[model samples]
Target: MKPTTSEMEILQVLWEKKSCSVREVHESLNKKDVGYTTTLKLMQIMLEKGLVVRDSSSRSHIYTANITEEQTQTSFLDKMIDTVYHGSTSRLVMQALGHSNTSKEELAAIREYLETLEKS
Candidate 1:
């Protein structure tokens, strides 16, 4: 399942830490300007949403991602491609290539990518 924006914020920290209690998650988020209770409720809601799994063996529930980082990114990219890029990966690639300060090596890599696509 995909997390909402707020929950995704918490999930990012959880992914980085591997596992963390609510307080640790809250403290990590506090560094990014989010409130403690807000992070708590967000994670609590995420637990209900099955975006995270909480270990209840301790007095404080320790949370871990039910979804891996790759799955999360793939989901996000799918949505963004469908919505923002009109389901066109080429459009996304073109936009990125045009927008960024890509080096010659990066351009050569992209050319190689296109050649591989053609060969396939």
Candidate 2:
């Protein structure tokens, strides 16, 4: 399932923390000053969306990402490339590079990856 932007934020917290309560999730995003109730509500919605699993056995429920980070990234990237890039990965790459200020080090890493791909 594709998570919304807000849902993705919550998933990121869960992915990083492994398992945490709503309060923990809220604290993680406290820099953004997001409300506790808002985070709670989003977590509930995420449970319904099958994006997270809640352990309600204890007083404070624990939440964990139902999907792996790589799985979600791959899904999002595949959909984006298919729709926005019209199924052309090279076009997507060019467009991304054209828009972003990629550092030389990052570009070198990308070049290395491309070389590996060519070798394969």
Give TM-scores for every candidate, taking all chains together and pairing residue i with residue i. 0.83, 0.90
Which candidate number would show the highest lDDT if scored against the true structure? 2
- Candidate 1: residue 34 Cα off by (Å): 3.4
Candidate lDDT values, in order: 0.87, 0.93
Q: Which stretches of candidate 2 lie over 4 Å from their true place?
A: 31-34
lDDT of 2 by residue, 3-107 (tens): 999889889999999999999998987657678999999999999989999999999999999999999999999999999989999999999999999999999
Q: Model 1, residue 33: what's the lDDT?
A: 62
**Which residue pairs of candidate 1 clash?**
none
Candidate 1, run of 10 with poorest lDDT: 29-38
Tell me the lDDT of candidate 1.
0.87
Query: In candidate 2, how many clashes are counted?
Result: 0
